[model samples]
Target: MIEDIYEYADPRFRNLTLPNTQLERLYDGCRWAEGPVWFNDGGYLLWSDIPNQRILRWTPEQGVSVYRAASNFANGNTRDQQGRLVTCEHGTRRVTRTEPDGTITVLADAFDGKRLNSPNDVVVHRDGGVWFTDPTYGILSDYEGYQAEPEQAGRNVYRIDPHSGEVVCVADDFVQPNGLAFAPDGQTLYIADSARTHDPAAPHHIRAMEVVDGRWLGKSRVLAQIEPGIPDGLRVDVQGNIWTSAGDGIQCFDAQGTLLGKILLPEKVANLTFGGPRRNRLFITANTSLYLIHVAVAGAQYP
Candidate 1:
């Protein structure tokens, strides 16, 4: 039963999940699974195995299969307004798009004549803009990516103009920006800071910001502080709840920044996304495996 997988901090959380559904592991064996994106056309899910340098796919009819090998150590993935795969690559230190025709197009790799530290996570706005995080993690170690020094002076969140092909720095003060997601209405945005890995005492919280004129308002307020583990990836539901990865499992928060409930996992969750036919199923990419669960709410669908 869902009760076996979740612990509720608020009674309202009871309505969010079913009493009979349980978490199911779809596949395992990856060194680390970080990003999980669903393809509506084929009803399959694609996720990145960062340390393995591969992207894996899963479907209901078949189990897990290699989606792309030597995937540039891709970390985060999403679909654009045109339904193409947009990815953040640690090895390549770039954000790229996989076209429907099987061609790869570089979206962004550098700014101000300097190479990016490493693009970590990415999201596509309905406005056709591509937003992503540039963190030093990929360049800091050889396991996830090649070891190197920071090429850019600051780690910042960037927005790529859909038409102008220009990259703009939306926020620049984060030590390590990890996961990000937008509300269904596109008015509010949430981003997680996982800087604690380096500082040990750094703030491990998800920040909220207002989006104005398709750009981050440049001001942030802490939405939630995750203990145990930092948030890596997240997705917004139609009800505006923020579902984020936590140390032991996934936590769901309401718009008021209230902790609603948590789905407990034995492994540390790295990231998650809402997928499936109607987007009510949540695809979770934990440390070394992919898990799924049926939820009562639907994922946000933007026009």
Candidate 2:
């Protein structure tokens, strides 16, 4: 019966999902949920409730609890190489790191002497670099973050050096960069442009580019174009497969950017992450609820 939730575009996708496992609705009541990060050591998961301005924690032992209130409208979250939680705050328009002692460290907030437009999604490189996407969604209205004028000339993707603490712009040509992820080997970077969120004629595709010298990027090419919705957040598996959020549910693509399959849900999905002990549990954040399902493959990002 669980197999009924999936639509296979490619035969390979059938091997990625399990038939016995059923999709579970973990919880609901969130205004908007995003940014799921799993901690293996603690056996817990943390995600953002943007409109509610809180970060909710979930565990198999205990259902759900408020991890941090007044979270500054956190959007995307990931863990650095050091295992510290790295977060993108829409309200503060900055990227931050949560230390073991529970204190927050500001990693990046501005570039070229101007304040950043709002850091959306973030990812950490194995080499200790902090990368994030800066878009104007947080400043466009007061629902998620405060309504204000964007200070940056363009939405850009930035990388914060591990050793120098220097912030550098890596990509500058995007209508609205939302989610981003790195390949297993950290050689290729994938970014989702959700410009169609406002303008229907804008791009609605995920771009793939070469990561040069851990700082610079090569020419980008459209890896996959989405329809019926835009790509919001995405994650890559060990095989270099990409799983991204869509209007209907989740769209999966193989390394070559081929449509592998789809996980269908009743509500539109906002973001997703792979978790569980084996990193095979796909945790999804939809409009106002959270869902989970088991997968056959493990996520490239480990605990």
Candidate 3:
């Protein structure tokens, strides 16, 4: 008997994912797969194989190829307003941007004159600010990055001023902030704390914060708690729904943070993003493979 992958908690979730549709396994053969980002302009998807220390690219025309070999153990990636590739490097312990000409520019590597622990995930705000999470996962072992002592006082979320080039800590109370994204309206930010991966008493939920004046974060509230696994990379759909990666698969939450449904996969999902021409294709990075499924929603495009 075939296992059912869709778990519908509400009637609306039935409309998001089709019951007859099949989830496609695109590629595999990685120690740890993560950070799937889609580029519509190129009609391809890029992701990191952290333990392999390389970034992989995939297209419908071509199956999979090495995008960057010496990737410095990159973790997360996103495109800026200018279409430049913004990435978080674990081995280097910094956030960087790949220019249009393929040149690399160091965006943020230290805070308060102290070296960063390890940049985990990143996203670009509508205001052109580069926001990212600094966690110690990369420095805790030699598997993904060089093991070393942390320099910063805590794992925090930071924002880089697009004009001034100054980095500021936006949130500093997280045990390990992993993934983040803004709502379609750009008025709210959702960040995931996967601290439960290290401590059972830590948060295993995602928090939603109102964007204050497009700069600061207002009072945050727990949006949803993940079970059987912690929340990792996340994305927001054009309809304002949140799609987050969890231990089992991807969890779908409505705008109000209600658990709508779940897409259960065989492997633990690390990250996900919407792609394809209409942005209806959901691309996921699981433990050692990349998966895709056609959904009824489109991803919110940031400017």
Candidate 4:
């Protein structure tokens, strides 16, 4: 008999349980949804609607509200070690940090005197440096932001040294690098290659690279090959499981690349973040609607 797709589970683990509850859609009617960041201090979740050029906030009481208009067509967002909001702006093609007082500080905008293509996703290192992926996806169309001429050669990942203010390319060879996340241990970096958008035959897979002496090394290995829809953004759980957004739902995979569980959703999930009072709530940006679910796992400490 053929294996049941929805009933399938990895053989290595068996505590999976499918929640009967449907995803609670918080708000809808967004042109395109991306970048989910959870702020525990404010008891709310924030995400970007790229085509709308706005960042939206959602709380249990207020439902949803506009956090900021003309958000530079922001893509991915995360909190730094100091709990400050770090964002990747497609319109500005730079990475910025939002201070506690609401001041915006540009972290990185150019490399070698040329503007970046578009900042995609970002993560902060323990040493205070910011790393992000720069791909041309945002500037290829007017849906997310105004189309602009390419300013860089190839899509690459860059690191901004907090102390020196120098931006360096850490990795360069990806066709269209998108979401990125460091493993809980900080020794591994996971990057989602959405290159299929440029090259139809290109494999859409999540690749893992080893970090050595502040540089990415070793052969890039395929962590997972997304089907139906490509992987956009993702986060790692405390237990080292990767929670990635796909067309079908949020897919979870073990550190060894074993598919563990999946949280099915009605719409295509763009990105997600773990937040809530206990940091166990998974806030998902599924197309226009935002959904939340309480999970047993906690988000990685550095995410």
Query: Model 1 lDDT vs. the true structure?
Result: 0.90
**What is each predicted model's overall lDDT from 0 to 1?**
0.90, 0.93, 0.93, 0.83
Write one digit per residue (lDDT tens) for candidate 1, span 61-170: 99999999999999999999888899999998999999989899999999988999999999887788899999999999899999999979998999999998899999
lDDT of 2 by residue, 1-303 (tens): 135889888899988888678889998989999999999889999999999999999999899999999999999999988889999999999999999999999999999999999899999888898889999999999999999998899999999999999999999999999999999998899999999999999999999989998788997889999877999999999988999999979999987889999999888899999999999999999999999999999999732
Candidate 1 similarity to native, TM-score: 0.97
Which residues of candidate 4, in runs, are more than 4 Å off?
A: 1-7, 11-21, 215-219
- TM-scores of the candidates are 0.97, 0.98, 0.98, 0.93
Worst 10 residues of 3 by lDDT: 1-10
Clashing pairs in 1: none
RMSD of 3: 1.4
Q: Write the per-residue lDDT of candidate 4 for residues 1-303, one digit (tens) a residue.
A: 113223235643234332443456778868888888888888988899988989999989888899999899998998888899999999898899999899999999999999999999998877777889999988898878679988898899998887898999988888888888888988889999988766779868899988776554456799998876888899998888898988788888888888876777889888988888877788888887888777766888774
**How big is the positional error of residue 288 in model 4, measured in Å on the Cα after superposition?**
1.4
Please provide, for model 3 over 1-303, each residue's C-alpha lDDT reduced to its tens digit, 9 standing for 90 to 100.
123789888888888887778999999888899988889999999999999999999999989999999899999999999888899999999999999888999999999999999999999988899999998999999999999999999999999999999999999988899999999888999999999998999999999998888888998999999987999999999889999999889999997889899999999999999999999999999999999999988989864
Could you tell me the lDDT of residue 134 within candidate 4? 95
Please identify model 1 stretches exceeding 4 Å from their true place: none
- Steric collisions counted per model: 0, 0, 0, 0
